[model samples]
Target: MEKRVVFDGKLLPYALLMPQLLITIIFFYWPAAQAVWQSFFIQDAFGLTMQFVWFENYSVLFANPDYYRSMVTTLVFSCLVTFFSLSIALMFAVQADKHIKAAGAYKTFLMWPYAVAPAIAGVLWLFMFQPSLGLVAQAIRALGVDWNPQLNGGHAMTLVVMAATWKQISYNFLFFLAGLQSIPKSVIEAAAIDGARPARRFWTIIFPLLSPTTFFLLVVNIVYVFFDTFGIIDSVTGGGPAQATTTLVYKVFSDGRLGGDLGGSAAQSVILMILVIGLTAIQFRYIERKVQY
Candidate 1:
């Protein structure tokens, strides 16, 4: 029999949960509520007066063709970031899981990037790819390719995608490494004895077992790309030579800060929130069904 511990008082259990509940209410629920409320009103440049326009802000937002472009850009960015980050991290995690002599050292080095702030990561990548003074840019130019992210929208998008992927790889690597280690050695050995090559064993056994973790990470990486990469966009391209790298989150900031359209910005935020929730639901509803666990 398993021993169980219970709190003596009902109120004590609620008391223990109070702080977290309060945080959720204050930080998350309150801001969300405010955004929803504000989306219906148009405010002045100074935010001095607000006029309720119902869905005018949203109507205007939807009517703009650039909004659709931003949507497309966001979809492409999220897909690229999520796919590359997971694939690269899985590769590194597999290498680390092999019980190498310097495994601990390698893991420590790999995870260090996760600790670096997104803004800093963006800046680091900027320095490495910044057309004239950048070493990598110089090397690329040397190879007969004219690589200037500042002048080229495609180059700018590629730079930010690379930075975002690199920053997130450490996080995915940590989770992948843990998931890989949790698989039983006997299962792997049995697959090997059955004449399965390493690649076959991995695809048929290791990967299937790791599907739950993979699914969870997939959702997490999407959210990370949506919200956390805001700082990276700010520091690196600042939405680019054009609106090339401007994701929806950055578009919200642009409307509020640069454009001074508070209502429009609020509307964009609300839509972005809905978009994230919808994506998460779609993933859990469809993708989770495929998980072995």
Candidate 2:
């Protein structure tokens, strides 16, 4: 009787969690485990031949010049997108938090971009930057500057970063606005009573309280830029101008889809997973600690 009761009690909580646990195992954990396993070997003979290579894929990847360049491009793209998106989101959030009229309308308008699909966003940007038909391109030419991604690697990268950052900013802004609203109004009033200037109050009180939101958004934005926005790269630059915009994720896609290098692609996926996990761990260990409750 005692054993039966204990078993039933233990099973109840686990039964309640079974659906989510199964979904995680099926969708996330299984694929991840497979990718890690396959990274150590190469497939041949139409999936009939398998040999344990033990870091050969990684060795070749690190030795390849194109891989190194892709890694660098990915890092730079993630950093620039995260920084610009978070900064602009913070600015907009602060403005939207005020008692100014039309704040709701402004926020709605700003958030419209976030609703657009990333692939569509990329196509829209492409149209806006077309050298002959693009409005911005025409303006740049009028300023005696030739803005051609086809001819300039740096220009291509700039276009990709700008497109990705534009899509990310609205999402970050939503989080930041929520964080701002959640802050206790009394804290700001107390700072004002202390004769603190508006800028000082913001820097000393508002910014600190917003740190938790900022940290959360930072991690999310970084991961999104790293993994999810490949559509922007595909539509805007196509990793073009001599592979300047070819990021790690883009390389993985190209290798798997175009190059027929499944094992290599799997290796890249594993590396990317490791990189994200390592960065997230570091953020939780150090950055999250600094965030105010």
Candidate 3:
């Protein structure tokens, strides 16, 4: 009886996970496979005819300057947003881990932004930055700085980065907070007893202990900046100031939904997926090994 009971217990988790496994296969894996299939073929307008072109889409994408620029812009956006979000999150997490008064309140407030939808956040930012009525624009003008997303590609890129970082900081902070809390209290106390300054302790102990969380956040944040937040780009800048803010995903959206270039959009999607997969594989191979756990 005991043996049978133990066997049942072992099977219970698998039973519970079956639904999620089925959903993943149906939704995630199936769609990915279909996308890969569609990438090499062109579909007729009525979906009646399909012909494989054998990398023709990829060839055209590579040959196009605009596609390359969009790819580069996406990479730059992901890197800058990840760097700034992680930096700010770590700083706040460290402060919260000290159990400062009102730290819970601070954390709650910081995380509230993440609860809001990205599209709504983009609209809110637009309201705050619009040239004629925006407080930020007025302040910039008052300071004698020419801040215009209409004529300046750099400013448009900066706006997108800023909006992305704002939405990302809270998510990163939650992870960092958990990482900080999981550090053994005795280890920190021992370091302090040895006359280790805060900076030294952080560099030699706390930061190292937090490496796994940092790495996880890095991957997730990169993926988020890549695929998500298109609404933010669209609402705030419309990929404008001469397409400076037109990241790869945004370009895919514009081509497919707006320009009716289904084949071209599908090709761009395949390229984006490949880029993400390659970057993720490299991270796991190199960065994961350096993480303590």
Candidate 4:
């Protein structure tokens, strides 16, 4: 029998929940409420006047073709970042899970990137790939390949995606490694004894077992690419090369702060929140079924 802890008094249970409830209200609910509230009102550039314009901001966003472009850019960025991050992390985790000399050192180095701030990571990659003075850029130019992220939209997009993926790989690796370690070695041994090749064993046994972790990381990596990569995109591309790498989050910043469009920015933020929530809901409703756990 499993034991369950129960509070003796009803008031005590409510009291125990108060801290979390307060935090939710203060941090999450309040800001969300504020965003929703602010989205309806158009404010002047001088901050001296305000006008209630319900749905106008959203109407404007829907009408603007650039907004749609930003949407497509965001989708592409998120997908690429999530795919590469998960793939690279899984590869590293598989190697690290194996018994090898200096495995701990390898893991330490891999994990060190995660400790770097996203903006700093972006700067590091920028230094490596910048068109003018970047090491990789110089090499590519030496090879006669035109690779100027500063002036090329496609190059800028690729740079941001690579930086974002690099930032997230370590986090995905940590979780994947933990999930891999928790699997039963007996199952793997049995698979090997059954004449299954390593690749076959991994696909049929290991990969399926890691589905839960993979799914979780997929969702997290998507969200991270959406929100957490703001610092990276800002530091690396500043949403430039003709606004090609401008993600939805950065779009919100551009509209709200730079463009002095508070209502529009709020609307963008709300739409973003809705998109993320809807995506997660869809994943849980459909994708979760395939997860082994």
Best by lDDT: 1
Query: What are the candidates' C-alpha RMSDs?
Result: 1.5, 3.3, 2.6, 1.5
The lDDT values for all models are: 0.95, 0.90, 0.88, 0.93
Question: Candidate 3 clashing pairs?
Answer: none
Q: Which prediction has more favorable lDDT, 1 or 3?
A: 1
* Per-residue alpha-carbon lDDT of candidate 2 for residues 127-205, written as tens digits (9 for 90 to 100): 8887888898888889998889877998888888889999998999999999999999999999899999989999999
The TM-score obtained by model 1 is 0.96
Candidate 3 versus the native: TM-score?
Answer: 0.92
Candidate 2 residue pairs that clash: none
lDDT of 1 at 205: 97
Order of the predicted models by lDDT, top scorer first? 1, 4, 2, 3
How well is each residue in 8-63 modelled by candidate 3, as lDDT tens digits?
Answer: 46688988999999999999888778777777877665668888898887788889
Model 2, runs deviating above 4 Å: 1-8, 44-51
Model 1, 238: alpha-carbon shift in Å?
1.1
Tens digit of per-residue lDDT, candidate 1, span 1-293:
99999778799889999999999999999999999999999988987998999999999999999999999999999999999999999999999999789899999999999999999999999999988889999999999999988879999999999999999999999999999999999999998999999999999999999998899999999999999999999999999788999899999999998999989999999999999999999999999999998
Better of 2 and 3 by TM-score: 2
| Superposition error at 153 for model 3 (Å) | 1.0
By TM-score rank, best first, the candidates go 4, 1, 2, 3
Model 3 poorest ten-residue lDDT run: 1-10
Pairwise TM-score winner, candidates 2 and 4: 4
